[model samples]
Target chain A: MLRNISVEINGKRILDNVSFEPNRGINVILGPNGSGKTTLLRVIIGMVKKTEGKVSLKGKISYVPAEFFSAQMKVSDVMLAGSRIELNEYTKVMKKMEIQGLINRDFSTLSSGEKRLVLIVKSLVEGDVVLMDEPLGNLDLANRAKVLRILKEYDKTFIITSHEIEVLDFASKVLLLKNGKVLYSGNPADVNESLLSELYNVKLRRGKDGWSNFRFDF
Target chain B: MKGINLIFLSLLIISFFLSLVYGQVYVPFDKIFSLHGVYKTVILDIKFPTTLSTLLIGICLSISGAIMQLLLRNPLMDPYISGTASGGAFGAVLAYYLLAFNLPFSWIIYISPVIAFMFSLIATGLTVLIGRKTGVYGIIVGGVVISYIFSSLITVMITEMSIRFPQVPPLIFWLLGSIQIVGYTDVVILSLLALGLVLVSLRYSRKIDLVSISDEMAYSKRIDPNKFRVFWIALVSVIVGYVVSQVGIIGFIGIIVPHILRRFYGGNTKSLILGSITLGSTILLFSNLIADGSLGFEIPITAITSLIASPIIIYVLVRRNAQEY
Candidate 1:
């Protein structure tokens, strides 16, 4: 939960007066690039110092960075980092993620999507509250769906930031942010085309699957 | 022990005995322990301390090197990369200068390591302060700059000394690194100190692993990255200062042993430090064997290590870059 969270770095405000109470499900933060989405996540986990704010989260928190600089360690070693899980528990988690065979492989040699999944599994096993930054960034369509499915059934607090609007379909609560200000904080279904259009600075239409950027006017 | 570690240990044992037997006077294996007079003096008094000091220094530098890499978050980093060796060398050279010219602080020659230790801390502290704002690359650049400045100053002082006292041999040979001149008292003291530092470092291995990932990761794990960085860096400076004060800057052993063994031993700090103990000593003992007038004259130990390490470092760099593509 965040209240009056504002972050200013080098005399430039990165996050203005922002606030939201996230529930025990996927609370998706929708925003354009540099709209302070990542900064908001970092502030919550105390990675970026909030200029002024009240951040209160009840539970252990783990973070999956947007770009994981994989250490020259094994996948299993990376997974068990800062976690009290046993090898069998790690194996079970890895099995669920379909990365059991990669337990012995060098983490650096894994593909980007595999690495992202590994970190996700790591965060999931390590914390009751997981803050993921662009977790679906490097994942392919199938892996994205796989990850989203796993997250939806995990029964924990997930504060995920994504530029991809498709995740909007699964979000229990949505916080629409534009230029560091929260424009909407309610049900995901309440997020409309016009507000999203304003948020991205372009005219958009909601298609059967998700929102799409169209240039028919041009 | 693992395969690599066992191999290294065996190599160390072999090299240890060989060094004892093949010094200035070839006291064969039979005479090394049982003989009296010159053979006993050479093996027990002269060669034992020299070889023991060399082994101890290797362990200290190698562990320090691995810790330096973790603290800096740069695999290429070594104990000397932060200017400690050059700073310690500067202090040693200054001590010699003062003694040679009967300067005000001429008595410092008796307790030169204290001066060297102080200078080493100052140099590394300056590097840390200069680079604190800019992160990894800044610290590396700052270290290089500090190292160069101290090295230049040492060269100037040595040059002046050479001009004034041409009959005395130059300190350049020692600066290049040699274990041939260490006495029993220094060896015993260094062994105890190095042993304590190594044990302390091993205890922090798990924390070092977490910190090496990233500061945010370290913070998430409830470990303060900045605090650990300072503690480890200070510890490494002490290790380097002691080694340099006793035997000058050995060079490359710190970088080379860790860089090489990390392949066979893996990147876990505990295992790497453990493996480094054996392998680092093995490499140095062999180098000392070749440098200890075995081929009729002495060679600086750094020369041998540089000859071995430079190519391996280049190969690793090239291979890493190639892998990235």
Candidate 2:
């Protein structure tokens, strides 16, 4: 479990006085763009140092950044970095991800969806507290569903950030963030249309088939 | 293949013999085996040490270059490019002039390199620290600044030294670099230092690869990027410092060797390290042979490497540009 995280950037509070205890399930930081989602994730994994709180966690943690093109290394090479896994196991993981063809391909050469899959597989193979920044970004519906299935089956603590409602369907809880503050933090089933509409300042209309779209006045 | 290894071994042996033979006065091959006279003394005392030193220096510079490239994650990073060599050169020149260190020196030779190595480490440390706060462009810019600072200091020292000591001109030529005669002690010190560095480098090659990907990625893996970066910069400084003190400045081996090896071996640090050492030593040996053999007067080894490397570098740049177009 990772807990007690507060973060600030350039002396302005971002994750101001925020603390949470993450259990063994999917916890999604449901927030709009630029709502301190990435910053909270960064603080959790010790990438960005927290200002006033300490992060106490057991076991290792793997963080997948929103932008993963930080290295020019090959797919397999980056995944097997500093681990004791053999070559065949690495190949097996790649094959399972259907990214076997991209094993030798440079990280810079992969498509956005393919890179996302690689990062997901990397986090899964390590089997730890996986913190991902928008893991579903740029992924098609099929790939997104495939990744969500994998995350559900892994049975580890998953902290993910995404704006897609379909991606958040499997999330046990959605922490609705607005203006860097958590307005609603509870079961996704309890988050109704009125609360979400007020949080995002948009009229969220629910349709007959359980699909909803937000209508915003510019 | 084992055959290739054997071939490299044979070439190394042949180069060693040829290096001993082709010096100021050519010792006849037939009389090379004789047990008596100046030929034996020259071979045992002078040529042997020079050849060994050349081999060790080549290995050191090349491995250092490979490490620097991986550490900086910059394709263009070299000892000269990062200003380590220039810093060492300044230290040597300072030792020659300011300290009035005499020729055919003993502990002073080691002392000069140690000083230069420390200075280069500090310079590179500062670069990495600033670059971490800023970015890659910042490191490159900082490298340029450090290089200019060391270059001007070298120039000032050279001018001042020339006025005080007439033999300082030859010392300046040494700073330009050559395959001049060195004692066995020099060869041994350099070989030991290079061996130690290579061992440490091999151990940290994986961490180096992590850093190459992204500092943040490395941090996520529980490896402190700052500590690893500082370690690598210090390692490169020591290797560069030792070479510059022993043999002045030999360029391009560090830069070109790693680049060429990368073409064949990909970016796996283990393979890259091995390939750089072998290829670097071969190139240095071949360049030294050309410097010693082709012309009546021995040219500086740096000139030979530059002459060979410039055209190839231009060719690569042109090919890349053409592809872009």
Candidate 3:
């Protein structure tokens, strides 16, 4: 239960007067670029100190950073790190993520999508209260769907930040952040396309398939 | 597993005997059977104790370097980099200048190392306390600052003491490190200390491995980085304190020996600890031999090692820079 966190960086307020109560499901944070998404994740994991508010949480909190591949290590080595899961469990997770082939490869040698899958699996093997920063980025559609399926099956509290509209489908609650402030907090289905388009000042044209034009408006 | 361990054990024995044999005056193997009175005394009293001290110092310093590098997660790190050697030097110099009561020879020899060890440990404690707020960089900076302060004090003490004592030149030679014969009692004590350190290091091998990955990763594993770091800093201080007390400031073995072994053995602590002990002992023995035997001059053991290690350090820097760009 991570809550009541406020963080500021370089004299700029990144998370301003924010309070969150997370239940046992995926809570997705949807925001545009520079919306304090990564900063909030860092604060939650106690990586970056909170300047103005307290971040209180119980149990283990595992964070999968966006640049996980920046470390020079073997893929299997990184997966085994900080995770108490058995080797068989790790291998099972790798197979489920469709990355069993990457087990022996160097992490730096893996493709971006493959590295993202490995990082996600590593975090999953750790204890509950998983906080991921853009877990689906650089992943292809198939791998993204595989990860979403795993997230749905796992019984743990998850707070994830992503800009992809497809990821919001898995969110039990979507917190809309604008300019480092919470603009809307409710169920994902309640966030109408027009409101999301209006929040970023972009035109939302509804097509037969879905809403398009993801580029933020000026 | 047994076979590998046996090989190292045999190598240690051979190296010990070779270290005793290869010195300024070669003691012939046949002379052991002849048993000349003075020859037996020279071999037993002088060369044997010196050989044992070299082995102990080598094992202690190398293990200290390996553990410090793992804790800091920086390849270039060593025990001396954190000001332990300078602090020890300061204590030794202070005792010489302030407490020149013309005590017994045994008192001067034994008490100096203990005083030096205590001073280095205090400096280590202070560094860890002040650096807690600033993180890793703070520790590095604090170490450098403390090193400078202690080094200045040593210089002042040396200048004042030299006027009164005519044997101050030999003391300076001792400061630069020499593998001259130590007493049998000192050898036994140093060996016991080294054995204790190796056991403690093995117990914490897993934690050391986790630290090498990254600090945040260690914390996520429920190992508080600060607490573990403090423990490691103390362990390293004791190792450095003991070795520097025995052999003054033998540079490069602590830094280069571990890295060179890491190239063959991976970064795992189990292999690293073992390899460092073997390789470090061999290098020290060889260096001491060159300083005393073939060189035919009273060359400082530290000078010989620096001559070998400086080029390797430069090569590592250039290679790292090339990789970075």
Give the worst 10-residue stretch by lDDT in candidate 2 chain B: B97-106
**Clash list (residue pairs), candidate 2:** none
lDDT, residue A43, candidate 2: 75
Q: Tens digit of lDDT per residue, candidate 2, span A1-218?
A: 33445677887778766666666778888777777888888776666788877677676777777874334467777776655557676677667767788888876456778877887777777646888878889998788777787778777888888877654467776777776677778777777778867776776754444432434444
- Residue B165 in model 3: shift from native, Å? 2.9
- Model 3, residue B118: distance off in Å is 5.2
Candidate order by TM-score, highest to lowest?
A: 1, 2, 3
Candidate 3: DockQ? 0.25
Candidate 2 lands at a TM-score of: 0.87
C-alpha RMSD over true interface residues, model 3: 3.7
Error of 3 at B221 (Å): 2.3
Q: Global CA lDDT of candidate 2, please? A: 0.72
TM-score of chain B of each: 0.90, 0.86, 0.85
Q: Of models 2 and 3, which has the larger lDDT?
A: 2
Roughly what TM-score does model 1 have, to 2 decimal places? 0.90
Q: Compose the digit string of candidate 1's lDDT tens values, residues A109-201.
A: 788899888888878887788888889998888888889999999889999999888888888899999989998998988888888888888
Instruction: Give the proportion of true interface contacts each model preserves, from 0 to 1.
Output: 0.22, 0.28, 0.11
Model 1 CA lDDT for position B225:
80
User: Residue A156 of candidate 2: its Cα lDDT?
Assistant: 87
Ranking by lDDT: 1, 2, 3
